[model samples]
Target: MEMIVHNPTEGIYAATDDFVHAIEVRSPSRFLFIAGTMGLDSDGVPGTTLEEQLELIWANLRVILAEAGMSVDNIVRLTSYLRDPSYAEANAKARVAALGGRRVPTTAIVAQTLASGWLVEIEVVAAG
Candidate 1:
């Protein structure tokens, strides 16, 4: 599949280096819509801190993507639900690291998590 990024120069606010306004996928043979993923380990335990959770979340995402025969490069979009707004920067950095600096359409929102100690939840859309 071919991914085309959309970030117009003048019509709206420019997108930051970490994310684009949108991604257009063309001729994708498969699409993977990952559900909200938390920073849970293989044994289903939440990480104690936001940073730990971010690390686990990315590792978990890698496994999930691999199960679908995809990798971080297949990620076309990402949405992060953060327990606090302050976690946004860390989350963005983790995302960039996971995707090897490849930017895509992304969003992050501060909100309460369903479970205690769950600092963040991430969902992804991948096409390949």
Candidate 2:
């Protein structure tokens, strides 16, 4: 009764089902884009370690998703931009932890991010 596209390229998902709920539902609640999630905590403090950064980022994203009335189960894709490529392996490990070590979302990797001294950045796309 529904179609799911796991991280389709071209910035769009072509599903025909009526969206029941979405992160940003306009006409239909199909694809939703979560903003770039960084290490910044809800209290506005940045994490100093990669592990801490990953935790903060995912936590912040969970809050954002909740505000949109969506959950991590709706996340279909993930784009990860890391400050240092050297930390890629560590980041991946952290990601596994964030995802509860299961249901790894469709993921892409980038070597650099926009902020200065930032270790990692993650953005999510969800379907509803």
Each model's lDDT: 0.93, 0.68
lDDT tens string, model 1, 8-124? 879799889899898899999999999999999999999898889999999999999999999999999999999989999999999999899999999898888998789999999
Positional deviation of 109 in candidate 1, in angstroms? 1.3
TM-score of 2: 0.69
Off by over 4 Å in 2: 1-28
lDDT tens digits, residue span 1-128, model 2: 14433434456764322221223323445667987788987777788888888888888888988888887776656778877777767777766666665443445466656566578888988767
Off by over 4 Å in 1: none
